[model samples]
Target: MAYVLTGCVAVIGSNSLGLGPIAPEVARSLGSTVPTVMMAAAAFGLGTAASALFLARHIDRIGSRRMLQIALALLAAALVLSALSPMVSVLIVSQLIAGIASGIALPAIYSSAAAIAPSGRESRTIGVVLTGWTLSMVVGVALSAVLADFVHWRAVFAAIAILALAAIAMLSISKYREVLATESAPLPLEALQIKGIKPLLIACGAFMAAFYGIYGYLGDYLHHGLGQPVSANGLAALVYGLGFGAATLLDNVVDRLGARRVMPAAFLATGVVYVSMALFGGSFTMLLIAVFLWGLANHFGLNVLIMRLSAIDPARRGTIMGLNSAVTYLAGFVGTAAFAPLHTEFGFAVSTFVAAGLMVVAVLAAASRPTEAIVHTVQSERQLQ
Candidate 1:
């Protein structure tokens, strides 16, 4: 079950990240500029953000497994269209459709991970599933680039489509039953009214924005500033991915500790990572070390965030996770756009500090208790006394 979920996530992750390395080839093939061809990626992100906001509530009503299968079908169609795109506009439309599928698919995957976990091992299970991102980052993405070079850029999308088909088959045969909603589920926007939800969502937004803000310029810093080759950047990506996967080994520890108890430390450690990167980004070796640590700290933080969001309310998990993912990708765009000026006027160092400042906000958001949770706890304590 975990393997199937992991495979599903791997396909989604590849759908997002695999386009970057081969954008040039895609541009040349379609007779468009690289930046123009990359509009497809942007369209996909927007499609995801919009779907997450509007379509996420339907996941519970439709059932996670069923919704996932349907979304994968949509993704397969989109990827097929992408493989056959004769122009950049067609590619953009195709990716938009793919993004729409991802918005639904990711929340379903998260909800499924929670549903399939043993009693106390939900966090660990989700952590294990999150490692699929590492698979995409370190393996699928690189392989796509290689295939684009040796075979054709279109083959990359076709390969992912095949993987999506495989995931659908695996999910169909999986025997677990989800507690699906009937026609009378809560309203779509009501998930935000749940206790402790607002703060968690705020933290998620801050964390995502901060990470992307600095990371958007990381390659440029390495290449133009440090004079490193393209291969070194790839090595940096690999090291970061390995670090991310390595941190999942300690997910059991997190499960034991409880996500709420560990939230502050995770965000703080991530803040420190940003500061260290700002301080040590000059040398290639030091930068790689910092990047690795960044990934390690980031994985724990992200893991706890997702775990908390998933556990908020089982019935509302789909909506809650949709909100989480909505902020995440939207913040990705915001971070990149907001940091561009700083990265242009200054070097990457200044933007790193700005990113760290956002982490401070994340720490505060995570540490502050929602009014309802605290009030309920206090009232319960008084009654006990």
Candidate 2:
């Protein structure tokens, strides 16, 4: 299960983080504009949203292990196609396919992790699984930047394809297959009827929009807005990645502080960080610090959201988690598409302030209900489980 989760992170991380740093290079190579290349990120997010909304419910019928195998194969094929793409349109299509594969795989990975986790340690176990994403930001983004600078962006995609293939090989093991063989139930719409769920989803969507709004164009922002070189963009991304990686330490903190308390505070802090970057990003040192702080708070806030949702209905965990993934990437689609034009028209500061506004919405929604209510509900559900 750990191996499978790690592989999912590598696949998702490489596709997502790798593209941002190399968007300019890809635009140049394909004779496309930066905004057009940015659409590829939207395409990926939309594809993932489609799968999460439509295909995620079928994971139980299809079987998690079997579905994971198919998704990995598709992801590998998509990466290879991306590497060979001759135009922006083809690259967008490849990214869409990759997103579909990710949509299919991610819920299964999270479900498997939750199922196999020791009793009373489920959140911690899931946190460990999420660390794969953090690690990917470090390894995958850095490597993509280095390759795009020195070699070619195509090499980055090809290398990730190789990693996907390796993950597929690891999935073929009988032990891993057996671990993921549990049957999933059809997604229950009633799960959405759970208390605080609607507000939580809204908050999550807003948070995602805010995060991706800035993140999607981070490379371009550095290159054009700040006049930094690609290498510097890569290094700054590395710093943010490191902070994101370090945020997994908060798993213990979430347990101690409780997600309800931590989530709202984290959202507020992240919002402040975003605004700070918007105002003071001209200073390279300040930019690095703000970006790193943004990463740390962002990941911790996301983890808290997941922990809260998982508590709502452990029996329908896959579906709930699927909804989380769907809203997240769907927001990513909107943020990437909408914010690019904002940056083009107004500038980075205006676009980033817009993101900060979205974060304000997230903070409000997160604080709408008291933590004790959620804790009571989760505790009751656990007893029933």
Total clashing pairs in model 1:
0
- The per-residue C-alpha lDDT of model 2 at residue 280 equals 92
Task: Highest lDDT: give the candidate number.
Answer: 1
Which pairs in model 2 have colliding backbones? none
Candidate 2 worst ten-residue window by lDDT: 176-185
lDDT assessment of candidate 1: 0.89
Cα lDDT tens digits for candidate 1, 1-385? 9889999999999989999889999998888898898889889988898888788878888898999999999999999999999889999999999999999999889888988999889778988889999999999889999999999999999999999999999998899798887655455467678888899988998999998888777888899999999778788889999999999888888889998888889999988988888898888999898899889888899889988888877887888878888888899989888998999998788888888888899999988988899898799899999
* Backbone collisions counted per model: 0, 0
TM-score of 2: 0.84
Worst 10-residue lDDT window, candidate 1: 182-191
Tens-digit per-residue lDDT, 1-385, candidate 2: 7656766776777787678768999999999998899788778878888887667666655566677778889999999999999999999999999989888888777766766666556556667777778778778787787999899999999998998888878878747533321555554465466566777898999999988888778878898877888777668767887787777776677777777898899888888998898889888889999998987887788778877776765555567767878988888878877998998898888887888899889989988875656788689899999
The predictions' CA RMSDs to the true structure, in order, are 1.5, 3.8
Candidate with the greatest TM-score versus the true structure: 1
